[model samples]
Target: MQFYPKGREQRLSIHHPSVRPRRLAVLRAAGVNLLLLQFLFLGLFCYIFGSLFQQSTHIHQVNVLFVDYDGGAIGEAVRDAYKKLEGPGFPTIIERSASDYPQPGSIEGAVCDINYWGALYTTANASNALTAAFAGGSAASNYNKNDVLTMVWNEARYPTVVDSALETTLKTLSQSARVVYSKVNGKQALQNLDTSDSTTMAIFYDPWTLASTNLQPTSQGSRLIYNTLVIILIMIQEFFYLGTVNGLYVQFKLYTSVRPHRMAIVRFIISAVYTLAGSLCTAGAIWAFRSGWQVNGNQFALSWAVLWLFAHLNFLVLDVFTVWLPPPYVPMALITWIITNITSILLPFELSPGFYKVGFALPAHAVFQVLIDIWSGGCNPQLYYALPVLFVYEILGAVLSSVGVYRRAHYASIKAESDEKACEERVAAAVLQQQEVQLVRQETLRDAEDSRSSNEEQETRDARPRRGTVTTIKDQEELVDIIRREMSRPTVESPEDRRSTTGPSFSLPFTE
Candidate 1:
C-alpha cells in the first residue's frame, strides 16, 4: 500500500521529482550536446596560451657557459669581473672546453635565444670576435661592423684618452715629488741614476671600472614575480568562475525550499572537486608540454596551500553574493567580474597608480601574489602577513551569507504561515456567511408560510357563518403555534464546519 495520501503523493511526485535520474539524463544530454568538448577546448587554450605568454615575458636565470680566451691583464680583469658576477641568486655559470668554443646554440650572449636573458661566451681575447658576432658583424671584415662594435670601440677609445690624461697627471705628481726630494736631500745624490727611474711610467684605471660602467644587470626576481602574478591572476579568475557557478546552483536549490546549510555543504564539495580537477588538469598539461615551469615538492606544497586558500576565498565570496543577490544571475556575475578586475588580478597592480597598494591588500590580490611567489621561486613577506586579511574576509563572507540564508528562510516560513492563515480565514468567513444566508432564507420562508395560512383561514371564515369565523381563528392560532415550535428546534452544523474543527485539531493553529 502507498504510505502517503493520494493527493499528497501526487504533489510530492510533482514538486520533488527524482533528481538523480534527472541529473543523469541532463548529463547524458550535455554529453551528447558536446558541451564538454567546448569546455575542454577553452581550458586547453587558456592553459597553453597562458603558459606560453608567461614564459615569453618573464625573465629567469638560465645555465650558461662563459669561456674566457683573453689571458692578458685586461682580459683577466674582464674575466674576473664576469666571475664576480656569478652569485647564488643569479644564473648558474658553467665552464666549457676549448672545443665548446664557437658552439652552435650557445647561450653566450647578453640575451638568450629563448628570451631567458642569460648567455655564455668567451672573453679571453681583448677584441672579442664572439661579441662582435653577437653585435651582428661578419667575422671576415671586422671594421665598422655593428652597434656593439661601435660601442666597444668608443669604450676602448675613452680608455686611451683616460690613459693620456693619467700620464700627464702622474708626470706632474712625479715632478712635484722630485722637487720635494731635491729640497729635502742634495740634488747630486738624487741625480745619480734617477733619470731611468724618472722615465718609468705606470697607468691605472680611474675609480670607476669599465666593467662596472658597461654592465647593467636586471633582477631575476622582478620578471619571475610579474609572470607568476599574471598566471595566478588567471587562476583566480578560474576559481571565481567555478565558485560562482557552484554557489548559484546551491542558491537556486535553496530557493526551491532545500535546506540552506545542506545546499551550502554540497556547494562546497562541488567547488572543491572542480578546483582539484582544474588544478590537476593545468598542472598535468604544463608538465607534459611545458617543462620549464619548475616546482619542487616543497614549492608544490606551497602552491597547493595557495590554491586551497584562494578556492575557499572565492567560494565564500560567491556564496555571499548568491545569498544576497538571488534570481538574476547576471547582475551577480557582473558584480563579481567588476570586483575581480578592480582587485588588480587582471592587470598589473602597480599600473593602478595610487590605489595599487591598497588593491594588492585584497584577498584576490594577496592570493595571486602568494601563488606567484611560490611558483616563480620568489618570496613575499606580505603573503604571510596577508593571511590574516584573507581569513577576515572569509569570516565576514561566511557570517554575512549565513545571515542572509537565515533571513530568507525565516521570511519564507513566515510567508507560508501567513498564506495558510489567510486561506483558513477566507474559508471560515465564507462558511459563516453561507450559514447566515441560510438562516435568513429559512426565517423569510417561515414568515411567507404563516402569511399564506392566515390568508387561507380568513377566506374560509368569510365562506362560512359568523360563528365559523371564530373557529377558523382558533385553527389558525394552532397552526401558528405549530410553526413557532418547529422554528425553536436546534439546527445541525454543516459538514464544512465539522471538517474545519477536526482538520487542524492535532496541529497548532495559527492566529492571523
Candidate 2:
C-alpha cells in the first residue's frame, strides 16, 4: 500500500484539464529551458567539430625540406617531380643546396627538432652507385639501391597527421620521382648494362626507391592513450571526485560547522592529493604497457611529473567554474573545456585554420607536446613555451578559486544572520500574542468575582471598600511590564537553530 497522501495518488496527464496553474507554469519553464539549452550546446559543439573543418585543404601549408645531394639524373628527376606537385593542395617542398647540409645527420636533426614537417635527402653517390651497377664493376654486385635516397621524418610528433597527410604526400612524390627517373634514364641504362647476367637485369628493372628513416618512431598501438585518451580520463576523474565531495557537504552539515575559508583550503588540498595519486597510477600504467618503448627511468619520472602538473591544472580550472557557475551549466562548461583542449592536441595547429592557432596556449596541447618530446627521447623542443603556458593557467586558477571561496563565505555569513533575525522576529510576535490572550482571560475571571462580591456587599452594606477599576489598571500595568522585560532581553539560538539556517557551501550562480 502507498504510504503517501491521497493527493499524491492522483495522477494527471500532460494535457489534463484539471492540472494546476503552478505545475503548468513549471512545465512550460522547463520545456523552454530544454529548447534553449539544445540551441546553445548545438552551436558550441559544432564550433568544436569545426576545428578540423576542411583540414585537408591546409596540407599544402606544411613545409618539407628537400635537399638533393646527388646532382645527377636520379636526384634531378626527384627534384623536378616534387616541384611539379608544389602549385597547390600539396606539401610545399623547399629545396636547399646540398652544400648547406654537408652532413646527412644534420638534416635528420632538423626534422627531429621540428624545424620542418619532413625532409628528403639524396646521397651524394646516388647516381654514381647506379652507374656503377650498370657498368658491371666489381663493386656493382654489392650495390644497395636502398641507399640512393633518404626520407627522414618523426612520426611520433603527430602520428595521425603525419601518416595521413605528410607521409602519404611524400610517398606519392617518391613514386612520381621513380617514374620520372625511368623515363629519363631507363633507355640509356638498359643500353649500357650487361643483359646476360640475371642480377644486372634485376638492377635495371628497379633502379632506386626512397629509404625512410623515422627519427622518432611511435608504438604500433596502445601508447596513443597518453597523447589523447588519458587526458580525458584525468579530467573525468577530477569531476567524479568533485561530485563525491559535493555529496558529502549535502549529507553532513559541514557548512554550518566549518569556516568557508578553511573549507576552500581543504578542498584544494584534497583535490591536489587526489590528482597526484591518479597521475601516478596513470603514469605507472603507461610504463607497464609501454610496448618496448626505449624510455629511461629519468624520462619516465619527468613525464609523470608533467602529467601531474597537467592534471592539477585541470582540477583548478574546473574548481573555479564549479564554485561560480550554476549546477545546470557546469556540465556545459566541462564539455567545452574538454572539447577545446582535445581538438588542439589531436593535430598540429599549423595544419588547421588560423583561429585554431590558439591551441598553442591550451593546457592539453602543451602537455601533449611535452609528453611526446619526452617519450620520443627528447626529439621536439617545445618545453620552453609549453611549460610557461601551463604555469600561467595555474596562477589564474589559483587566484580565481581563492576569490570565489572568500565570496562564498561572505554570502553564507550574511544569510545566517538574516535567518537568525527572522527567527527572532517570529518568536517575539508569538510571545506578544500569547500574553494578550492571558491578559483577557484574567480580566474575565476578575469581572465574575467582582460581580459576586458586589451582591455580598449589598447584603452587608458595611465598612468594606470594594475592589474597583484602579485594581484592574494595576494588574494590566504589571502584565505590560513583564512583557516589556521579556522583549528587551536578547535571545540565544541553539546549535540546532544555526544548522537549520545554514545552506549548502557551494551555491549556484542563479541561486543563493
Candidate 3:
C-alpha cells in the first residue's frame, strides 16, 4: 500500500518509509532554524572580526615625544628631518620644551608611565661637546657619539606594537636624524676642524649616534599568552565548570530542594573559590617558567588576585547569559563574549578607531594593563584606573547574576506548578476514560443476555424456531465472549491520551 495518498505533493522521495508528511514538517522547521542561525552569526561574528580591520591606518594616534634640549645645529637638523618625514601611517611626533623634562630620568618616567609610546631627546650641552671636540684638543679623542641623542621607550607595554610599529618607526627616525645631521653640519664642521689631528677628524666624521634605552624589555615569550591564549583558556575552564555544576544540579535534582537565593550564594562562593585556585595555578605556572623575570610575593599575589577577579567576572557574565538565553543560543553568546574581550586587549586601544574606546571599560584591557604593570616592575601606573574597572565589572556582574538566578528560579517554580496541574488533569481524564470503557462493556453484556433470553422465549412459544428468525444463541454467546476478552485485556485510550502521557517535564538546569 502507498504510504502517501495519491495526488499529494511530495518534496522528499517516496522510496523510504520515513519520508512522510509529519517528518518532513519537522525537517522543514529545523532547516529554517539552521538557515536563520547561519545569517545571525554571520552578522554578529563578522562585526567582532571587523574590530581589527585597517588598524594600521590609525597608527597616527600613537604619540612619541620629541624634545630638543641642545639648542645647537645638531638638534635643529634632527628636528627639521623629522618634520619633513611627518605624515600618515606613522606615529605623531609631539615636540615638547626641554624644560618640561629637565632631568634625564624624567624622559624615562614619561615613557614608562605610558605618556608617550617612545621619546627622543637631544642631550644637554651636546652642541658644546661637539664644538669643543672639533677644536682638536683631547676632548676630540674622548668625544662619545652616543652622547648626542637618547631614545627611551618601554617595550613591555605592548610588545607587538612596539617591536613592529613603534620601535621600528623610532629607529627609522633616529637614522634620518643622523643622516640629516651629517649633510647639514658635516661640511661646515669639517672646514673648521684641524685636519692634522686624525683622531679628532675621525670623531667628527662619525658625530651623530642614537642612544637607545628600552625601559622595560619584554624578553619572556611565555608572557605573550596572558592576553591572548590564557584568556581563552580561562574562559573554557569557566564554561566547563559551569556545565559540570549544571550537570550536578540536574543529576541530584537540587533545584527542587535548594532555595534559589541560597543556591545563588553557594554558586558565588564556589565560583570565587574555584577561580582563586585556578588563578594560583596560572600564576604559579608563570613563576615556574619565569625565564629571568623578577618574581616576588607581592607581584604573585597581585597577579593572582587580578586573575581571580577576571575569571570570576567571566563566570558571572556567562551565568547571566546562559540563564537568560535559550540553550541553543548560549554558544553564540560565548563566542561573541570571547572575541569582544580578546579584541579589546589584542592591540593598544590608542591605535584603534575612536569607536573602540569602549575597550577602556572592558575587563580584559584592565587586567592586561595590570599584568603588564606587575611584570614590568611597576612601569605602568594605570592600576588606579585599571583596578577600579575590574571592581566595577565585578559589582555589576554580581548584581545582575544574582537577579538572573532569582528570575530563573521563579520561572522554574511556575513551570513546575503548571506541569503538576497538567499531570493531574491527565490522570483524571485517564480515570474517566477507563470508567467509560467499563460502562460500555457492562451494557454489551446486558444486551447479549437479553438476546439469549428472548430467543429462549421464542422457542417456547413456537416449540420450533425458524432458521432465519433472528440472530442465533451461539452467535450471541460468541459476541459475549469477544467483549469479555477485550474488556479483560488492557485498556487502550485514544491517541491524545498517549501523547499527553509521554512524561513529566523537567526544569532546565542552567541555574537554581
Candidate 4:
C-alpha cells in the first residue's frame, strides 16, 4: 500500500470520526468527573473551615466558674457586672461565700473571685500587704492563697467575654466610677489622694484588657480558596486537553496520512468548544448552588466571570505546552504546579519572595489576585490589570500553539514523504537486484551450453574416419546390398540439415 504524503487532500477533517468522537469523549469524561469532585471537595472544605471559625469564637462558653469573696456593696457591683455578662449561650458563673473558700466539688466552668477594699485598707496599706505576701510572712500572711487561685481562674475567662464587650462599656464605667468616688470622698480629699493610686480610687479597670491582645487570626479567605479552585480547574483542563490530543494522535497515526498540524487544529477547535461548554456547565452549577443558599447574586456573577476568564486563559496556556512538548505529561503538570505556586495562587502575593514577582506578571497571578480581592471585599486594581495580561497570555499561547501545530504538520508531511521515498527505494532496489540475478543465471546457462557443445563437437571430430580408409563387407551378398543402399542415399545433406548441424556449434559460443 502506498502512503500518501501530507497535502491538501491528506488533511484530516475537523469532523472526522477519529478526530471528533475521541476528543469529545475525553473532554466530556474529564469535565464530568472533575466537576463532581471539585464541587464535593470544595463544599466539604468550606463546611469544615466555617465550622472551625464559628467554634473558635465559642470556646469560652464551655466551662466557667465564679466566686465572690466580699459580700459588700463593692462586691455586689462586681457580681452584678458578672451577671449582666452571663447568659444562656455563655459560661455558668457561680458565686461562692468566704466560708466556702475551697469551693466544694468542682465548678462546671471557670471561677471568679471578687474582693473589696475597706476604709482601713488604704492604697499604701494594700501595697504593703501585696509586697509582704511576696516577701517574708507578715500580717499579709493571712492573704488567702485560695483567693489568689480563684482570681487566676477569673482572669483566664475574663478576656473571652469581657474583651468582646470592653470597647462599648469602658467610657461609661469610668464616668460612673468617678462620680461615685467623688460623692464618697469630698472633692478636696480626692484631689489630695494620689490620682495615680488605683488601689485607693474607685477606678473601673477593665481586667479583660490585661488578658486580651487584639490579634487577628490566621485564616484562608474566599479569595485563597477561589485561587486554589482555579488551580484545580486549570489542572482539569490540562488533563482533558492532553487526553484528547493523545487520543487523536494515536488514531490518526495508525489509520491515516493526515498532517499533525491539521489534527492538532481539529483537536484544538473541538477542545475550545468543549471547554466553553464545560465552563458554562460549571458556572451554572455554581449559580444554582448560590441561589439555593440565597447568596448575593452580583457577587456570584462577578466571581463566576473572573473564574471563567481564568479557566479560559489556563486552557490556552495548557494547550500551548501540551501541543509543543511531546509525551510524559509529567512535565506539563510540573510546569503548571510551579506556575500556580509562584503566582500567589497557593499563598499571598506579598508573602511570596521577590523572585516570584515575575509570576505576578503572568495572567494566572493577576487572576488570582483579583479573585482574592473579590472574595475578601477590598479594592482590587489588579482586576483591571489582569484582564489585559490575561488577554496577552491567551493571544501568545494561541499563536505559539498554532505555530507548533503548523510545524508539526510540516514535520509530518516531510516524514510521510521521506517514508514513501524510502518504500519506493526499497522496492526499486529489490527489483533491480532480481533483474541482475536473472541476467547472471542466463549467462551461467549460456556458458554451460557452450561447454557442452564444445565437448560434443570434439567427440564428433574424434569419431570421424581418416581420409584413405576403406570399408570391407562381411559377406558378398551383404556387401552388394550395403553398396546399393549407400549408393541410393542422398549424395549430400539438405540445407535444413546443414543449418541444424552448424547452428548448435556457434549458438553455444562463450566469451573469453
**Leading candidate by TM-score:** 2
**lDDT, candidate 1, at 145:** 19
- Superposed Cα deviation of residue 234, candidate 2 (Å): 1.6
Which pairs clash (backbone N, Cα, C closer than 3 Å) in model 3? none
**Candidate 2, residue 208: lDDT:** 70
Candidate with maximal lDDT: 2
Q: Rate the local accuracy (lDDT) of all candidates.
A: 0.44, 0.78, 0.77, 0.45
Encode model 4's per-residue lDDT on 133-162: one tens digit a residue.
333233333633223212222211112233
TM-score of each: 0.38, 0.81, 0.77, 0.41
Runs with alpha carbons beyond 4 Å of true place in candidate 4: 1-225, 246-250, 253-268, 281-304, 322-333, 336-343, 373-379, 436-512
Model 1 TM-score on a 0 to 1 scale: 0.38
Q: Which candidate model has the greater TM-score, 3 or 4?
A: 3
Candidate 1 lDDT for residue 324: 65
User: Number of backbone collisions per candidate, in order?
Assistant: 7, 0, 0, 7
